[model samples]
Target: MFIMRNISIMKTFIRRRHIYIDHYDLSSTGISLNEYHQRRHSLINLIRNYIKTEQKQSSYNFTICLPSSTRLFMGPDVAYFPFKQQSDFYYLTGCMQPDALLLLNGNDETFSTNLFLSSCPMNSINDYERWYGPTITDKDKICQIFGIDSVHSIDKLNSFKIPSSSILFYNSQITDDTSTNKKNLIPFLKNFSSSIVCNQLNHFLHSLRSIKSLTEQNLIRHACQLVSKAFIKTIKNCKKNIQNEYLIHARFQYECTKLENTSMAFYPVVAANGRSNILHYQNNNQPINSDDLIMLDGGCLYKQYASDVTRFWPINGRFSSSQQQLYEILLTVQKDLIKYLNSGDKFITRGKLNILTDQYMIKYLREEFILSRTIDDDHAKRIINYLCPTSVSHHLGLDVHDCESISFSEKLESGNVITIEPGLYIPLDCTDVPSIYRGFATRLEDDVLLTDQGCEVLTSMCPKEINDLYRLLDERDNSDID
Candidate 1:
């Protein structure tokens, strides 16, 4: 039954780019480094055991692929390595180093794990290393530290021959294949005839990852706390004179990085005024006006795992009556959605609640003169699309928008973590929208974990209520700016 279910799921699984935040520093709540390392080691072992079990059914050996350096970065600068969290690689190895690979062999009743890494000389001269620092150089030292069975130069992969019974498992799309001379592992599988199968393993890893172990949950919770701190700092920095959105973004990033050796889970959405209407807006170059609403969607990662959270506030430390009303409506929808997030509930079915909430909001808008009464079902759908088009939630984990093979209709499990973000985007020039609702976009998002009872808000530390937000902003303005 499990095999059938997995096979059914694989048919619909489509890989999408996910964002994650790293917040490893927020975990210093009196925990020692040694204790953290011990916890990480246990997590690694747990992942290894699962991988070992998958390899048991086949006569072939198992190989884990790593992200190559070329794939990780686009330029010489450290910032060029576009932020991406490799979930499977992070799971088994617990190493966040980029441009490295891992291979495991378990054919002769002796299980061994081998790590392939870029040579040290490459890092000695690379600008990325100079700026970001090297993760690992000496293969022997890494093997000793991780207690892996073996270590090999990544360049030696092509020359080193594997037995005919070896089967390679990797993230089919996640790893970079740009290197001209590197051994193309996928092509090599075809040379071995029908016995070998190049299986895409990310989905299997995703399912396992969705259900966070006790330790993983604790790490995520800590990461969320750190992000909440950063959010508080950003709110404090929002002053009437300071208009640049990038300044706030930079401040948040600085706080997060300083606190936890991790970076933003993804490129932050720091939109002000009308720009906030763009759902994935990250170009924070706009000047924030005191009268404009600012929406910030971001998170931090802890040891490559992530926490994603979003909050919206007024630049002048208080929302206008209209802005407050719209913001409250979105927040209400988000709060209502949270009530339905639970085990055995289908995410798509839960999504229907979002549609219902949207319809209700539209009706309310019509009554309030924010929407046209003549708008038909088609126009209503378009209006809703403009307001809150995307599903109210998605899976969250190592990647901010983590991998899940199941469709939206699939049943939710107790351990799954997701986002409940309901928003309204009113463009400035839309004649269809009533005058009062123009030029405003409000989004209320929070990380949630499905529990036995219903759902737990992982990002509850960040204020979402209009009154609370106004108070928080006012407090920041009075104490910090002056």
Candidate 2:
């Protein structure tokens, strides 16, 4: 059945490969021709196996979607061309360079993979090639490299006949702008068969991605270490002269860029003083006051996987008595919460762990005179709500938020990557709080993986202890003065 489909598809090269050796220059670290090939091969096998496993239950055809052309300004002069599929393209072709598409047809008996990409301009002097560099225009070479049965220019999509019983799996979220051309091509396939379904492919792909195979885990672990080293460098570089939060953010980025496997997983949150209260703060534009507590929440992307972490420090190398008290409370809550995140444990509510942690924090606050009263009814409710706005943990993987939709009562499995973050926000204007507790906000965040026995903290390289943070800050300041 697969062989017949391939014959029917007629794999022909409509686009020629125009290899410009200069294209490699666009890569800051130069292109790894070998890595690209290896990734494609790895993905092909993984997908084949997935299809085989699925075929046992039912017969369905699989199609992968790619991101379409969208302009990304690398600089004022250089722009990046778009691609069709994201993970699908990356998995099948290992082609990071965009504006490509892929289709895989698998029946219960056989399967064939096809690559559809943009054609190279016939004119040699095309400005896009000169400005942006060469792309894979040759269908033959791509077919040879990826071992796909056939390759064709995207223009041939309309002529192709899709099997009626075939299942078309593509990203449901492909935007009109990114997939306008592909959307036109979909109608042609439907003409051949009414069985075409734009099933959600990302769910299956994300599930596979969330569980770190040995190779994937190593890549993420390397990224974690790079971020840890960058954090250390950023701390050491901190001095009295650098007041601009943007400057500090740049420093962290500079350090990460030096490492091969490191870059910000997401925008760094360099919030100082009260701004730390805003959970996803990315406007690192505030001035860093000597007396303010600075919160640095950032991570590095390792081989496309992510590592998320957060650390807090006093700008002047010493936390005041009030700051120290609040910081300790947050740290203690995080530590205790982590102890309960064991494998197979089921949480009854979405934020049950966070709620419990907040309860402990409220008790500490009342006992330490941070809160005037420990009234179990209104006071306790207010304390819990103020300290933790969201759940203490969330699924974390390739994307920072990761992708498990399973909710409370679902038992945590061993391979899940999650973040444990507990925070307390104290507003300066609040008249209800004691003077010592006002204007102080603190949060401790770390990424961890659930193991069979317990859990392992992937981002624990950064210090979280109140004493350790102060000591490191003081050491940095003292070294700077010398």
Best by lDDT: 1
Candidate topping TM-score: 2
Residue-pair clash count for candidate 1: 13
Candidate 2 local Cα displacement, residue 192, angstroms: 9.0
What's the count of clashing pairs in each model shown? Answer: 13, 12
Q: Residue by residue across 107-183, what tens digits does model 2's lDDT show?
A: 55565667676555343424446665664445566565555678765766767666656555656566444443566
lDDT of 2 at 78: 68
Candidate 2 differs from the real structure by a C-alpha RMSD in angstroms, to one decimal, of: 7.6
TM-score for each predicted model, relative to the true structure: 0.77, 0.79
Tens-digit lDDT string for candidate 1 (386-423): 66667777788777878656457655677778878777
Full-model lDDT, candidate 1: 0.66
